[model samples]
Target: MTQDPQTSSDASGAPASSRRGLSRHLVDIAPLKASPAFARLWIGGAISGVGAFMTTVAVGLQIYEITESTFAVGLVGGIALVPMIAAGLWGGVLADVFDRRKVVIASSLASWASILALVVLAFWEQHLQGLGTHAPVWPFYLVTTVNAITSTVSNATRGSVVGRILPADMLSRATALNGISFGAMVTVGPALAGVLAASIGLPWTFAIDAVLFTAGFLGIWMLPSLPRLGERVEAGWPVLKEGLTFLRRSPNIRMSFIVDAIAMTFGRPYALFPALGALVVGGGALTVGALTAAGAIGTMLTSLFSGRIAHVHRHGIAISRAIQVFGAFAVLFGVFTWVGMHSGHAAGEGWGGTDFSTLALMALAMAGMGASDELSAIFRQTMIIQAAPDEMRGRLQGVFIVVVTGGPRLGDMYAGALAAVTALWFPPLLGGFVIIALIVILTRAQRAWREYDATSPTP
Candidate 1:
């Protein structure tokens, strides 16, 4: 039998040295060197992502400021959920059948328009006061839902484009790079949004996102047209059914989705950050930004030192373990919040009035969760890209996007609802344990998933 290139010795066939150089752990730039198109897309996305995140933070703040309700804030995700789901399924079909480049460009334009609409609403609320003392929150939800739908489609197309652009071996490195991109956006975007919203105002903060969106166009414009790889099918249920059928057959891929859904649904704590900063941790917007950025900090560090991730042959085991670690950290975060509540530390008044000690502990726990989540993301994405057939990549990627994005929305609902009824800390504390138990049970039931190997590309 031929030795697997991933684990085999060099041409000499001698045992490979176990000692990889220190440089092995750093962010691999080889993918950038190999594909200029991918590099451009990556850089453009990174630039635009910061602006997008700023908008995200600003919207949450605006909603909270208007209503002072965590449930209202969480409803943002709920409103977007169904539309995003439809877009994911339909968009995957579009990506597979139509020109992916065009699909991305069109979706990007829609997303840009949504951001611009937000900009208009923000300005209107500040100067016109058209809807009363506070801006009508419904419009915010309407525009963000549109943005979510378009962005979800755009993401599925973009992910498909990556597989077409890069070689199979480079997929893992590319996944790592993608993690770094996300980490950068999550870290810088929220922080910038907080500072911008706090200093200038919400209108200007949203305007920045609208302005930054232009960068994405530049990257997509440069890409060569990418047509469908298989027999072109109409963009309808038939196309979606085909993809679903494939997923049903692919146990490893299905398991990947299931595990991710479990983690996101149970372990997501982001929806509570605004309330925590305002009512629990007490640094206001700044504290929210810090807590939000903490997870990205962990993600960034993990990606930076992800040198050894590419060598792991047992991707299934890695993904499972990483998610478990994420759950553990999430549980820890809940415990920290519970302790702070019991300690009777009054919530801080504003940005400067934070409970730093408790905030630090919570941030640390969130960071740990972020790091583990990123690790799991890297492996799961690599599995999807490498294991699935090229023709099915977009559809699978669409499902992946749904799981990735939809899971958090569900988490938002879970956290928001549970927090409204109980203490802010209860959801994650309960969810984390649920994640660990469900994942262990599910993985054990699916023997194939537990023993999955990257070299063979089973899914």
Candidate 2:
């Protein structure tokens, strides 16, 4: 009888290994072990991420404190969106044409400078005796906008560099590690920002980010030069048009972007957290922090045990299913908020009041939603990075950043506008249904997308 080649034989010619290898399904760390450069970059980014989140929270608090209007606070994201989009696209072209290491290093310095400017402004505001509650909002916007643009470019450049550093088989595990880094950033950064801003004030928060920015510089500086491969194109409108044309031809890639846009646009409920904490959940700032961190906690946990996901072959189906689960959790979160609001709990109360039961339920729902979204992100990113050619990876990674970042900004607008007319709970409840139904219909129409295989990527 013929024997299977995969099975090991004993000295007596009997099969020695019959049990299947479960380790193959586990999160593979070969990429980290094989490449020292990738490891340094990853560690630096993770450390810097904590500082970045601190400034993000501090800036929003400063804006709201000065203006006292939700509209003004929302405008922070809206104002930066257009310039960020342009930077993302333009940066992609530059990454393809220039040395990626130089692009990243230059952009990192610009970001560091912007953070330093913020520190100076914060000090100026504190020293002025008669400034009262309001500090100049324009400078805050200006520095943040500059920071946003430079950070976008640097992120796009680094993403393109990942493909060059790691092998194709290890891409999925690398993405999982990235998700873990992001999870840590979101979880720890905001919490630290709140404590630091309250105790040490805004200047120190910005200063911390400025100091951490050096790690990013060090990581980029250590990398070997990465010049453009194959035919090079000038960084201009023609290059941008070429990338778009390629995107237009790749249906699977287009669908990945569309699905993510849909999920973020309809299901994101972060804009309502402040209102819900104060008037509905009754824990005020503490409640808001809990809700915000819950999602990141879920993301971190999912990535920690992402052993099984590495073996998934049908990426499209996995993405669609994960997103659907995310939508379902969003619906549950909305329902919990609505019930809590009507349950005679303390409304509009400050931080001292507690509503543990309702807060726990809402947090659980948000955690579920976060985990599912992270799963989908891992698959979608892996598909793009592995499927796209090395030459076009930079341009595509730029587009990916734009979609991922821009989608939430659009969602903020959607949730804020709808909550103004209706209750804060109405938008997520309705939007969740929209996300589920729309994704189902869209995926059904694209048969090729549902059947996408990792071993043989179509796009």
Instruction: Quote model 1's TM-score.
Output: 0.95
- Most lDDT-accurate candidate: 1
Clashing pairs in 1: none
lDDT of model 2 at position 350: 45
Candidate 1 lDDT tens digits, 1-459: 856545765322233353246765577777888899999999999989989988988899888988899999989988899989888888888899899999999999999999999988888777645545776789999999999999999999999999899888888889999889999999999998878887898899999998888887899989989998757668788889999999999999999999999999999888888888888778788887888899999998889888667678799989999999999999999999998777777887665667888999999998999899999999999999989988788899889898899999999999999999999889999999999998889878988988999989888
Error at 44, model 2, angstroms: 0.7
Model 2 — which ten-residue stretch has the worst lDDT?
10-19
Q: For model 2, what is the C-alpha lDDT against the true structure?
A: 0.81
Off by over 4 Å in 2: 1-26, 124-131, 282-284, 347-351
